[model samples]
Target chain A: MKAVGFKKHLMLEEEESLFNFEQAIPEATGHDLLIKIEAIAVNPIDVSVRLNGTETYETPKVLGWDACGIVVAAGSEVSLFEEDDLVFYAGAFDRPGSNAEYQLVDERLVGHAPHGIDIAEIAAMPLTSLTAWESLFEKMRLELEEPSLNQDKTILIINGAGGVGSIATQLAHLAGLHVIATASRPETIAWTKGHGADQTINHRRSMPKQLHELGYENVDYILGLNDIDGHWKEIAEMIKPNGRIVSITRNEQPLDLGLLKSKSAEFMWEWMYTKSYYQLPEMITQHEILEKIAALLEQGRIKSTANQIIDGINAETLKAAHALIETNSSIGKIVLCK
Target chain B: MKAVGFKKHLMLEEEESLFNFEQAIPEATGHDLLIKIEAIAVNPIDVSVRLNGTETYETPKVLGWDACGIVVAAGSEVSLFEEDDLVFYAGAFDRPGSNAEYQLVDERLVGHAPHGIDIAEIAAMPLTSLTAWESLFEKMRLELEEPSLNQDKTILIINGAGGVGSIATQLAHLAGLHVIATASRPETIAWTKGHGADQTINHRRSMPKQLHELGYENVDYILGLNDIDGHWKEIAEMIKPNGRIVSITRNEQPLDLGLLKSKSAEFMWEWMYTKSYYQLPEMITQHEILEKIAALLEQGRIKSTANQIIDGINAETLKAAHALIETNSSIGKIVLCK
Candidate 1:
């Protein structure tokens, strides 16, 4: 099988940063499914994993998360999938990724792809949608209802034009929350607004003041997609008593949790790989969430967040996608198709 | 009305630490209920309010949270109670406390006292029980069912012989979780066992090793009554992936929240006063919880955790109770009764 991989962390401009290589197609066993990769999406995580490390690997590391594929074979223990079934998934962190012709994945983490969606669009929906869905519904425990209790409650999405934030804003709106999303640029601001943000605040300015001007003294929830340390003070100040905060961002410094103590707020981290990494009993929840996402997409309740598409699944195209994501200015997801 | 209060932050041994002062009785208004206090419980917060301050106040600040009393008057909007109702409550943090002969509290934060329990026992329950109940049921969001899905789950209660822990261990036990409680002293260890702790680990020791010795590597839930800053690293290390941690203890230092990212764990602060303090729409939940607590007490499903009692609700008695709490050596709760 042909795969896109890197033996060392290097600048994207370097020809060796990502290269085409031949690897054996792994066998499916113990609930694993052999998937033929059709389309893949590039996220900031792929860029960070590629560039943030300094040491060279003993073997090439294939780095991709979101993939739209078809199951070519299934393990004896796999009950959920079989040959020729279309699937989409954000694969596990410890395994060889889907930036390849074929990959092996746990059937429990794979979901049937939404019918009638383009390959690039279907590929873009898995990773970010899983993250946003789990963060809002599972981790933050937002209750969905006909007349949701979240109608009066507000949610502040930092960096609302980012991949997860784009989907989060839409899902939060569907959940009946008043959404205030942060976007510093004109195009991004308009993009977030289009994604169901009731209002937009600039992350470059004081979020609390912007929220105050928007008439919310404090938000009932905060979903941080950018830097958590940078926005820690603002999040603390803007969270209501007993509010929930879930972040996918990394904090370089220690967080002053005392800021949320008086309000008795909760803080949760949403790493999409946790269930897969831990082999948790709820790993199949990913399958459930993705199935729901597929329904939402097919029903037009949510549209694919794929903003840019590049041809081919080889090294050169992946390098270009990584370069775009590295800029951190991309409005939505970047998809690469074979 | 005579109140036991202090104008300055002083050691409990000081004569002026808790002095008798005369003040005009406050009238009930809005949702307020004027109650004649018959019993008061000394919690860690009372000691905190007395000792952790800088400048003296213009007037003495009364510091007591839990109380059992008779309602002498009700505000026009107070529909929950009327004159002559026997109630128990942990009043708001921003208002005058229960150390006075007459105190005003919101009717929503008060519960009808258990019919047959003594005032001292009832007073010892409200604050600690509320903290425990909220942390377990609300913060950790544990489902209530016997032989629950929690049967295979484990919980670690740090400082498991204190007021909240004594009740929390019993509650967690009743919820069908395997309880690993921390206690340093022999008496506390015995007390924790008596309260339904399945296993006891010393928080002063390497908690992870102790857990490993007991055939467990990580816990499914953790309830921290000890210092959060002190046990943070241990708690983070021993918490299973996607676990929940709820703490009633305040961390005086900044916390490294990044530790829980990979595991995607949850951290929540449990301040019993948050609902009433914010006048949140869910403030009535406290009244509902207390009513349940009273029923649980009546059914013998839970027991009062009052460990020591002072003879009178006066300055000297309050000073003794405060002194015991300040030492941090007291077991269970200390109450001062008329």
Candidate 2:
């Protein structure tokens, strides 16, 4: 099988940073499904794994998480997927990822791909959709069934034009929460509002003032997609009493959780790959969430965050996608299709 | 009206640490009730307030929370209690405290005193009970009615013999959870066991090894009644994936919240005074919780945590109680009654 991977940490411009390699196609075992990769998306995790981790690797580490693919074979223990079934998943962190001709994913982490969407679009949905869905419904404890109760509540999404933030804004809006999303550029601000943000605040400016101008005294929830340490103080001040804050961004410095003590507020971290990496009991719920997200996308209730789609699933195309994501100014998602 | 208060921060032995003062007996206004204070409990918060904080107030600050008294009068807007009703409460932090001969408290923060408990015993309950109830039910999201579902779960209560921990262990036990409490001393261990801990581990020892030896690997919930910074690493290691941690103790330094990222765990602060201090919409819930707790005590389902009773609610007695709490070795609660 042909794969895009790296043996050492290097900049994306380096030819060896990501190169074509040949490896034997792995056979499915236990709950694993051998899937023929059709499309893959570029996320910050993919870049981080490729560049930031230990450089001493015995084998080239294939790094990609979001994928739309078809199962070519299934292990004896697999029950959710079968050969030829189309699927979408954010595969586990410890395993070989989806930047390959064939990848093995646990059936519990795979979801049926939306019937009508293109492979690239479906590929872009899984990682961010799972993150956005779980961050809102599970971590933030938002009740989608009771939109009326959420009508008075508001959520502020930092870096709202990004992959996870785009989906989070949509989900928060669908839950009937007033959405205040942070986007510095005009295009990004317009993009966030198009995806369901009721109001937009510039992350580069004073967010609290902008939120106040939009008539929200404080938000009931805050979903931080970028620069958690930078936005910590503002989030602490902008969260209502007993409010919730969930962040996907890593903080460079320690956070003063004491600031939230007076409000009796909660702080949670939403790592989408947590269940799969930890093999937690709730790993099967990822399959359920992805299926629901696929349904919503098919029904047009939610839109795919796939902003830039590059043709071909080769090392060259993967490197291009990675380079675009490295800029950090890319609005939504970058995808590479077969 | 006689009151014990301080205008300056000073040592307990200093004449001004807690001094005698006189003021008019405040009239009940709106939801307020004029209570003839019979007893008051000195909590760690009282000691912290006296010693910590940068500002010295122009007016003498009366520092007390837990109180047991008779309602001498009720405002026109008060409907929950009448004149002469025996009530117990942890009144609002922004108001004049219960360390006075007569005090005005919002009816919503007051509860009917248990029928069989002494004034000192009842006074010991309000603050700790509210903190425990909120930490377990509201913050940890434990369901009290559904014991069957709760039976499989376990909760680790840090500092199990403290005022809040003593009550929380019983509540968690009554909710059907296996309660693993942390007690450093033999007397505290016995006290926690008597309060309903299924097992006890010394917080000073390896809690993780102790839990594993007791046939458990991780806990589903952790109520941190003591130091968060000291036990953070162990707590992070012992919490099951997606577990909840609620802390009442304040951390002097920043916390490494990133440690819980891969597990997607939650951390919440359980400040019982948040509702009243913030004037949150859910302030009424505190009243409801106290009333229910009062009923539970009346039915003998739980008991007051009062460990030592001082002779009177005067400066000398309050100073003595404060000094005892400052040592950080008090078993349950310290009450100063008139």
Superposed model 1: Cα runs more than 4 Å off: A144-147, B145-147
lDDT of all predictions, in order shown? 0.91, 0.91
Q: After TM-score superposition, what is the CA distance of residue B264 in candidate 2 from its true location, in Å?
A: 1.0
Give per-residue CA lDDT, model 1, range A1-338, as digits (tens). Answer: 99989988898988989999998999999999999999999999998888888888777999999999999999999998879999999989999999999999999899999999998899998889989999999988887544368888889999999999999999999889989999999999999999999999998899999888988899889999998999999999999999999999878999999888879999999999999999998999999999999999999999899999999999989988988888889998999999
Clashing pairs in 2: none
Q: Which stretches of candidate 2 lie over 4 Å from their true place?
A: none
Give the TM-score, chain B only, in order for the candidates: 0.98, 0.98
Q: Which lDDT tens digits does candidate 1 get at residues B113-170?
A: 9988888899999999899999999999886565567899899999999999999998
Candidate 1 CA-lDDT value: 0.91
Per-residue alpha-carbon lDDT of candidate 2 for residues B203-230, written as tens digits (9 for 90 to 100): 9889999999999889999999888999
Model 2 DockQ vs. reference:
0.91
Summarize candidate 2's per-residue lDDT along A54-149 as a digit string, tens digits: 666768889999999999999999999878999999989899999999999999999999898888889998999999989999988898768998
